[model samples]
Target chain A: MESQIPRSKSQLPIPDYQSSNSATLKVDRVTKRYGSGATEVTAVQEVSLTVAAGEIVLIRGPSGSGKTTLLSMLGALLKPTEGTIRLDGTTLSELAENRLPDIRLRQFGFIFQDFNLLSALTALENVALVAALAGAKGKEARKRAAGLMTDLGLKERLNFLPEKLSGGEKQRVAIARALVNDPAIILADEPTANLDSKIGHEIMRLLRRIAKEQNRSVVIVSHDQRIKDIADRVLWLEDGQFKEMVTMATDPVCGMAVEREKAAAQLELDGVTYYFCSRGCRAEFEAERRGQVVGDRLTLQVGRP
Target chain B: MILVAFRNLFQNKIRLVISVGGVALALLLILALDAVFSGVEQQVTAYIDYSGADVFVSQEGVRNMHMASSALSASVASKVKAVSGVASVTPILYVTNVVVADEERNLAYIIGLPPNAAMGGPWRVVAGERIPSDGEAIIDAGVAEKSGIGLGDEVKILGEEFTVAGLSDGTATLINSVAFISKRDFAKLRGDPGTVSYLLVKVEPGGSPERVAARIEAQVSEVTAQTRPAFAAQERRVIKDMSTDVIAIMNLTGFLIGMAVMALTVYTATLSRRAEYGVLKALGARNGHLYRTVLAQALISVALGFGLGLAFTLLLAAIVPQLGTNLSLLISGASLVKVSLVSLVIAAFSAILPIRQIAGLDPAMVFRGK
Candidate 1:
């Protein structure tokens, strides 16, 4: 889900928030088919998307809907049977097999649903190993890994093994690993599914902050609907293709999906307006934001329209 | 990749022990069988090796005494004694027969000794006499002990009874035991009054046995002379040629079993951690790295098992003598080299299946659930 895709508030086309930055990852109508003759299985079909720098695209879908296949093709882990996947300007599908590994190492980072930390290595070493794989010196890799872990709030848990760490810490370590190589794009598959709600949101927010601050592209695929608030653009996929996605505005009160014209209450916070599903939610928002920095145009309206 | 391979190999302590034990046991089977053959080779040639002769003159074209007829005219010994480098000559009659004692009998090499012989007598008589007198015998100590015969005991040889006069050492092996009797009695029993089976000659100080042997061949008629080492080597070869096929079959069986054990061990370790290997591949590790991991693991196991097997063989060599039997376990250089080569082959063979498995592995398996 690139920012330049045709997503709008009222079916009216609007400029992308990050149209100024170039696309780091681009997939042009890629199709992946397995087997042949009667046993042909089309796991992914004609999926096209472009992700600009610092853009966070969350692909949400039901199970077995080709979310993983699309993510795999985007990450260059699997070659598409048709069409092309390009990182910056190089088409990954046309490269030699020997060249794909270094591209995967230095160009695209991967975060798995299960964290997938090597059980034998410590948390710090797990992140450092990725840097070393990209040809960083040992001392430099360790230092980089240490800094990433500390920045991710895992300073004291660096020496713990994956089995010894909590679910949240493991995912954070995985995030650090995905970022350790400083790749142009990060492909995360169900990264927050194993985590609880509070920790899951924190991880999503951390991912958003990292993508924005580092100008790195992030594409997350998950079934968890609760993470839509943190995503800049949430694209829906079904049956090996993308449907017209809902540009939803989440109601913080009851965590309901509140579209722009379907809000019961609205509170403008800073430049962006926050829509509430009810007057009680808007009142709670106002009491919570008393004496806080409110937006200049604090539009307080309570109506169904 | 090396670190992961090591962790995978050593992850299960019990399995590691089983793997090491399998290799060690396989190595033991091989080294022990080879060492037994080596000991037999040494024991079969004990008489020739310990006999105090610098040169041996036998019937023409006879190089070894075992299972061969070597009869020279009695005058050949005299002519050999006349050779320039000959210090002394002792002629002995040799025959292969059995010694019997009260329903118990075993094969024996019944040797004939001359009276006051200089070289042709029991070289190591641990008891009464080196050369037997008439109507008396010198018996191997090991054979005597096993047969419950003592000094002064009467044993039947060639259907005649002779009292045991001395007990000798290094004269018995699994194949046969050496028993000594006087040349007069041997000639009487054989009824061949003027024949010598062999002539043992000692060279003077500062003389070459090979040169003396060549001179004796030139001077003596109807006889062949060989230096002591050449003759001893021939005797050992005689034994080796007889047992090579059987020992070779046994060694080959042991080596194959060793390879199978090592292969099974390395393959099991690789299989148990197969997902981790897939993960490594998915992480952009080349197949060369994974192959090296497997090969290194197999070779390490072989090296450890080889060291363990060698220690056990040396311990067997040390403890075998205390059992007080004629069975000796001689760990020779040839046996060590043979086992070392066997180990290298075992390691290489063991790594084959695992490397193939890794080479064909699809990295997509890492994304799939079990």
Candidate 2:
């Protein structure tokens, strides 16, 4: 079989943010371990990366690949066992426990797969609550929250509760909440996992636009390949170790990366060959090409780590 | 943050109802228990409190009229009236006896009074006329209502028949109801016309009752004298000695039950919202913010529950007496404030478990999608 791994680290297409003039987040040789002795488990191992301002970095892996663990450490929600994480030139690992929350409040915004909005609050209130915790109060927080919601095309649904909003609309509100604080970096975990293809791609587009327009760094951990095109760089992990990073084509139907050498099926369209991860993906792609309306195939698997 | 906390409480309608209802029920139990005890205490001292006398002269060594027997010559009234600062003196007899009404026997405290005395008689007459002639008696309205007997009814006391001439309001105690009879009838029943139980005294204008009481004690031999308030305080002490332990046990039971209900309801509500709390922590909410949120929810429930419980107690106070129960509910401002303080303390205590959960919550759980 042809080697699926890229030949050299230089050919991986990873953005050289280390040499860039403006790096917003820097992770150096980070490792996270749980338990010890005979019951030891390493969730993440010796990973280093840098994300520059206005760049979007996507981290992809299968289940149990420590993507969530790595994301947690980057977001300052958890401490790295063996390395340092820096955000905007400040070393997060050296900060006191009490000051970490202040750092997270002012410098980082997080989006989760579950759209973790408080169900009791209206969309506007949910977005405004973050700003309120950061010391903005009353009308000021509401005004900022309203502007973000309107910018996200959710102005009409601002007063609706989370239960009253649709899945796609809820993700939009979550995105609005994350951007409400105007943080230096945005950390997202499987943000599009709960949305349909069109809606997921829409959320990905919103994140991409947020990075470019606001000049904020975004780091996403996801399994969905549809958003890979929007990323300036991509990192892959397997078995708690960094694997070869590959820039490959994505199956348009199923949103899975497809290496051309090991393609399950391929077809030429408009003089360009598209590779697929599965026969079903090829058939779905062909059906779409033949003007068939394939219903959304986004099936949510809840409680995934 | 407070608005979000309040909104979280009302998010689930059923949960809100159950939580608030639990607290309300607990508060109702506590307040109702306290009010009942207060009503009992008020009733226990009603006779002395309503007498409008300045001093009471009992036999020497007598502390309270209800607890011990005291006897003095009826002529002591004259000796007491001659003391300086004495305006008037009336001799009265008090005895506990069984009265048969409608063929049902009930215990009562029978007081013998002079025909024209201004002190030591029913203060407020709710029905019929006051005790007029010999062999006529005045019954308390509580006893009349409880025993299904009213004015114009005949009753038997000490094997002698007497007409129910009038009714009095709030003249009954937990141990015995008040029944007023003429001194002639009481003398006949006692086989001695010159003996009395105690002498009720009124001081002249410009004279202090405390001073007059002290003078009476100095001037009268083999007799004890007390101001009206001192006499009432003695009666209250006797009642407390008899029933304080039981009432205290009941009050403690009420407090514990209320605390438990409040703790459980708040715990369940907090547990259900633990995920949302984790999300808040992930969004940079401090432990203080989360603590305030939980405490706010608990306090809101407590306040609403207190209002409901007070309303329920007032309703019971209106309805329970009509249902023919001896339990009296007395709602007072002091008791209301006391119960409110208790409910707040319980609410604050109930927030402990939820606050701990939120404090130890890992913001990383949000990334884990659980």
Candidate 3:
């Protein structure tokens, strides 16, 4: 049957940011509080950070350090008591709560720590749900979800429910769902907390590889220091403040430091855009091109090796 | 999707069964009362239709045939027969007394007609023979069935002994069980052998009952005449008024209580499944869609309950003679539809609050697990 899947722009994942190239996400002095008066408790206080496109940002904090709160604010899940958040170029703090859902759907893809797949649906069905919610047609959504699950090495388990899938398989299904809508950014809160160390590190490697290969910004809120080496920059959040970060990658296609928000140039190929930190790297990429058409079948299935 | 909603209901079989059972029991109560009311109405109307006399004359204020204490003098019969267009006159002597069958006495009615009266004889006899003399009586088949008495058996009524000579179809009082006897025996039992209770007057051929009834009323000072139907209707109206408040209250309470329970069950179920509702909201199910799903669930519940309740009530009516005569248990086709439609309205109304909650659910909640 002819599929009616939404034809996303080839430049999805690395959308052009007009002229505001310095930041893909910016948090300017954000604060969040619960309760009132005598019972008032500050969850996140005076926190600030920035992430450039194509860079993986690792947020490290203890349970009560308000890591989840910061992630929620960035994802438009919660409102800030004091400060503004900007995604790409739009101010998120000013958006109404009723309209927050639309912003989340259009710009953000989420991966919860618990791998929250609906219990009644299968792996393919779970991934298809996000596409369906984004207004994709039934047959097309299912087709795209099947392609995504097959790429995630879950082809054989596509029809299995959450209870039937193993822990790592469930997380993979959730990740496929997160990427299904082609959102500008993926916000994963403790995405590997429920898996074993081997599977956990495997998941982190997958996230870092996606960031570098596909030029999509990935933000993971976690306290799992074992996977810090995979992040391009690690921001230590203590008592609701960003303490430090380190840059670990220089874009091969550009002679500039890799940052989550400040990519220098973007190129569209096979309906997806690849970001570079400088124009020089983009030229080298063009010179080396074989001129062979980068067809729709660019994403290869990721089976465990 | 509605497919998901339907699957959710089947996911927990025990809860679904229990919920259906509760609805059925509630529906049964309402249906039982409706059937009884229906049965009593048919009995009354049937008796009136078969009585055949065109006009009825009795004491000026007397209402029902069962209230024989209001009997007028035997002279009223002759006065009514003398009216213009009157073709025949039959005195009806009706009296009630306690009669024993197996050491247990029940209130029994005695409808007394003349030995050879064509206007007021038992229309159908199911056993033995009709009352032949002053000391003989024809018992209602229902009365005989309940008392376990038979033809030729002697039953003592109000201190006088009479032989049960026959068994007739129908019962005492359109709403009560009764036996038939000769008019002379009825007077003897009531201790007034000369005074008769009601005068049944047949209009002459080709005469209108209304005109003759009017003429008789104007001529007789101690009695009034009415078309047979009007008199029977008056009798039923008088009896109904005496117990209207009680019956109305019982019916109202039953309906209200059933509605309250149904509403609570549907609302509580919706609240418990709020997260599931959020999933539906996120899937682009509009308010109208949500409303239809809830309405469908309610309609199904009420329909199942109504069917079960109606069947149970009919079975009861068939098995118990007292319920057949007194309680009515008519179960008419239109009445079945009416009661079920009433329940459907109740179910639909009860689902409103829950559907409103579903329609207003925040889609983000589906992601937040709230």
The TM-score values for the models, in the order shown, are 0.85, 0.85, 0.69
| Error at A167, model 2, angstroms | 2.0
Task: Candidate 1: count the clashes.
Answer: 0
Cα lDDT of candidate 2 equals 0.81
The global C-alpha lDDT for each of the candidates, from Candidate 1 onward, is 0.80, 0.81, 0.69
The deviation in Å at residue A145 for candidate 1 is 6.2
Q: Tell me the lDDT of model 2 at B324.
A: 63
What are the per-residue Cα lDDT tens digits for candidate 2 across A137-197? Answer: 7799999899878867787999999999988899888887887777888899989989998
Candidate 1 deviant stretches above 4 angstroms: A1-23, A117-165, A168-182, A197-215, A246-297, A301-305
Docking class of 3: incorrect
Task: List per-candidate RMSD values in Å.
Answer: 6.1, 9.2, 9.1
Report the C-alpha displacement of residue A230, candidate 2, in angstroms: 0.8
lDDT of 2 at B311: 91
lDDT by residue (B39-133, candidate 2, tens digit) is 87778778888887889899998968776789998778788999999999988988889778878777888889889978989988998876546
Q: Which model is ahead, 1 or 2, in terms of DockQ? A: 2
